[model samples]
Target: MTYTQTTPDHDAGTPGDVGDVVRLLEPDGSRLADAELDPWIADLSPHELRALHRDMVLTRRLDAEGVALQRQGQLALWAPCRGQEAVQIGTAHALAPGDFVFPSYREHGVLLARGARPEGFMLAWRGEEHSGYDHTTINAAPPQIIIGAQTLHATGWAMGAQRDGSDDVAVAYFGDGATSQGDVNEAMVFASTFRAPVVFVCSNNQWAISEPVTVQTKYPLAGRAPGFGIPSLRIDGNDVLACVAAMRWALDRARRGDGPAFLEAVTYRMGPHTTSDDPTRYRTDDEVERWARRDPIARFEAYLCAEGVLDDSALAEVAAAADALAAEVRAACIGATTRAPETVFDHVYAESHAPLAQQRAEYVEYLAGFAAEEAR
Candidate 1:
């Protein structure tokens, strides 16, 4: 699963013909001038820049805690977002309060940015609840477990918003693997045909579990959108500033009824796909080490420090906040109570149903038989 960077072919009509990836912040903390993107983030203040850095630090801390909890048997599983914090935090920060989000299972950073409580995030992983937060409250859907499904949900929601004549945009976050799914293509089709006000964000993390991106496609993922008549951008996912600018561009277009846009955030997965996965078997330590050098948090920290937006005290404050959040999440996950098994049937229907009631009764009786045998 070692990734080798290939030069994109600029041949017209070819998939690799998509323009260069949009990058505003270099890996070494230098700024790359982009006239089109500069205006998008030009109004950001020093405080806002510090906040972005803090968000990345907090996200990485949360991810670390999640991995530890799963390894310690506190959670069923955890999908690590170690190297993709910029993609999540930056895009989420660009969202308006009225905008809706549809996310894949690994979007904890997005949920956090959308104001979801840390405790609520642990509920689903602990098997104590079906969803972590109220979708209506945050204008985001529950994390979709099925690969590529959230894209369809986002498209449908966007269509609904268009019908209601609302300017709010719908954003869907998915992994590179999901782009290969039929649901994703179908979503693009419907979105393009109707000019749906949606943004499709593909976090191209270079691997789909054990498979490398090369196995999926030889061309850039962003190029696929053009075939559906959707404009797209390829962005450097490790640069938070670029992510924010790119997302703002896409969101603006969607809000203006310019139809759906696709974004391919080129990033790498520095950790295992999930706590249950073993990266050592499928990827090299060298590859992981190389990506670590481009660590999103570290890069952003460097940039902020250079700009005098953050000093030692500011860094320490952010670290302390992250530590506090991680502790809170850990305690909540460990202390969460397991629900009754019968409760699975509780939300199966909106209201009472005759057949469902009978089935529930039979299940109850079956459980009672075990108790009767134990008593005897």
Candidate 2:
């Protein structure tokens, strides 16, 4: 992953690169180094690079800061997407205004890039009962914590979009482990048979709770997509340029009425799967250090420096800006508004099922009884 190392020569397939995992940027920080993707970079301007930097930096800061809040008990739980910012943000950027995105809980970067209010995510983790803002406002569905359920939801959304006379697309993000789930397979079948306008983005970050990605799929995850009749692609998930381009292509295909596509982003989960899990038992520090060498931030910064799009002073300023953002999130977390004590009863049911109603009443009465004792 060192900058001096020559770009890895991949033939679009490696130990399991089933979907033609294209590489536009080198793990060591070279861009357009993938001759196949050179045109995309040549077309990108310096300002675009700056915007990319901002998105990636802010996302990473939020992820790290959110994890800290979890450790401090400000949040009940947080799934850190610490090292996967480039793929998340890049893909989000590729989405159009009418597109819908269904995300797994770890996609904070995608939501942020799609203009999701930070409060929506924060309040959820703070133990709030609902999304702070309506998801449709950002062309996104509410975050789903269940492993692979969002795939079906996304497919259904795409079907609706198709019936409504619009060509807008839907992108569903899931992990390597999700590919094996029946819901995900059924989603693929639905999308393929109906030619739904959807893109299934699988971020194969090499771990499912504690299982390696290899265990999820015998072949490269991307290859599984084509088997379902969806043209699939695999790309260096850490390479910002490649991720953006891959997503762009997928979106274009969907909008053009070409049907759904699947993308397997080959990256790594650099931190614990969640605040509760420990990676040390399953992975070695040396392995982590090796991946760190291919840090997306470091890789892009080096590319920017090489391309004269950013200098040390500029990077220092960005880092400083990121630090301030982190501080702000930390401060905001300390004062995160609590859910109203009565909220637990408010949305328990639509028409009010008798069983649930009884339970809610009992719980409220119990709380009231405790309060009366305190008053006495």
Candidate 3:
């Protein structure tokens, strides 16, 4: 089914089809010639293509390690991106250095792609910090834990960038469930009205926790954007090339002052919602197995192999690099130092706020009194 219920005003695509699921790679690992998308990816050398593959591999490894850490009690929670690596990596690579990204909590691949240090990247999952990296350095905001709030943040940031006369754009990364949120809808309205240079990327991974996408909307998520006077596209999220091409197109439009755009990436979540969730409770093994056959990494590996871009040695090197990354993340997570209870007050403000200062002092005195009583 297309993204939404059709009216005579339905301007998205043909009614019965899947609403223009853009693709440049077939499931069998063959690349198709597309005039529109080819130019966007033409500059990528063979070495660069291999590096993209490595990025996907390493990102997946990082996610796997995070899940394992959570299971082993090193982390309070972990979000898996097992089956959506291609979409995250592809779109992240399309971003310019000056561009800003506002991401949902599950965007581990985006974090790694944007150059977040593996050690710091897991700090929030380990319950150690409010954010893992400096937003100024990465040009990416910390992952937003509150549903669709980041969309509003991105729109506001983009408005500021526009007023500053900069070519920089902002992107909001959210999930399928987030599109149903009133905050996201309101953000779209503001973005459209103000013509903000923002891109809204919805990774429709079939399921939002236990609820299916159908429960969220009767039509494609992309269909929601046109109502706000923004252009939108629905693409095959499993195809990395399609993601890169689509993102480039959308970013170009935003940078050219054509206002905002929306992208709906059709993918699947192979793992549970988080380490705390159980997929078997809601989904069937057969369905998961079907998506497994369409694995993005496997298809990309096959394409690279077919193109003579990867040999056994190269493949071995990529695997080794992924393993090394996982090791680094694990060591960082295990060796991370826990802060004292009082330390939580350290970074709450840039300059000391009187009220917080008083509260911190009072709490410290209370702790000291308890220690003195225990000594007696």
Candidate 4:
């Protein structure tokens, strides 16, 4: 799909399969005195602005809590989505229900907005299976932990949508780190050649583990997909309005039979790579603090408060709701259904391999043998 960004100064995209402009609405909340922001705010209804702020705040808290859960040994590892909430949630909320999403590991915010229960994710961190949810229930794909691998699945799904004559689009959410992966590049080629109705969204958080984005690409990440014959845009990812507008533009065009779009949401990753990586060993506290000042939740909240819709009561309600959500998720995580002892061997092939089944049967007999010995 050909996409142009919507800015306060510029109109969206022109019709007839043309590129759109990338927008930066309300640059720094109160910091930047851009007169253009007022009209943008007026265009966005109060409810939409509040929803954007609330979802970002709740998701950030979820990320922090997930980190604590890992440290407490409830999880093997946790990926923090701290500074990228605005980009994820905004683009997610802008999507229509018919649209499908293929999310990378850190897209907790996107999953939450899509009504994915956090309990589904716990099984993966607790040494169990890694598929977050059944894809048939929601328009979301399973969580792909293998970095940019989701791009391949996304491109394939988009091709299927085209063959099935469905106008619904597909979105693949990845990070700057994944852009270096061969799977991501291969996906661009697949989608471009097929003219699939897909949106490749790169949440370029400016860090890939310890390596800076500079090491990943000297050129802008958005420029990568265009070479594959796909149209693309780079937006200020921290700005919710900009991100949502970009998604809307892309999805609308895709639904109208335009090809795929590649979106680079320029944001920052403010936390460690995972619970295992101690960012303090390489990144500075000053760097984290600097991004903290530009926190997506904080900035969005300031805008909401300025608009006067985010009252003290609304703030308290959101906190209480978010805490309740965390409590529910924790309770569910603690008591997820136990896996069958031999489930690992059940789906290993088209039909169960006889040798594997024999081994599982032997293991069961051995357990029974121990039980009989204890009885004696």
Q: Model 4 clash pairs? A: 1-259, 1-260, 3-20, 4-20, 4-21, 5-20, 5-21
Score residue 22 of candidate 4 by CA lDDT: 46
Q: How accurate is candidate 3 locally (lDDT)?
A: 0.87
How does candidate 4 score on lDDT? 0.76
lDDT of 4 by residue, 237-330 (tens): 7777767777876787677777888888877788888888888887788877766776777777776778697999999988987898788667
> For residues 12-82, could you state the per-residue lDDT of candidate 1 as single tens digits?
22222213567888788988899878899998899888878888889889989999998999999999999
* Model 1 / residue 199 / CA error / Å: 0.4
Worst 10 residues of 3 by lDDT: 1-10
Instruction: List candidate 4 segments past 4 Å from native.
Output: 1-23, 30-44, 346-376
Superposed model 2: Cα runs more than 4 Å off: 1-20, 33-42, 345-360, 369-376
Q: For residue 372, give model 4's deviation from the true position in Å.
A: 12
| Best candidate (score: lDDT) | 3
Clashes of each: 0, 1, 4, 7
Residue 273 in candidate 2 has what lDDT? 93
Q: Which candidate do you rate higher for TM-score, 1 or 3?
A: 1
TM-score of 2: 0.89
Query: Per-prediction RMSD in angstroms?
Result: 3.9, 5.1, 2.7, 6.1
Tens-place lDDT digits, model 3, residues 1-376: 1232223234544322333677788777899887767787888889878887999999889999999899999999988999999899999999999999999998888989899988767888898888878989989998998999999999999999999999999999999989878999999999999999999999999888999887777666777788888888788788888889889989999999999999988888899998989999999999899888878899889999999999999999999999999888998899999987787788779888889989999999988998999999
Clashing residue pairs found in predicted model 3: 3-219, 3-220, 4-219, 4-220
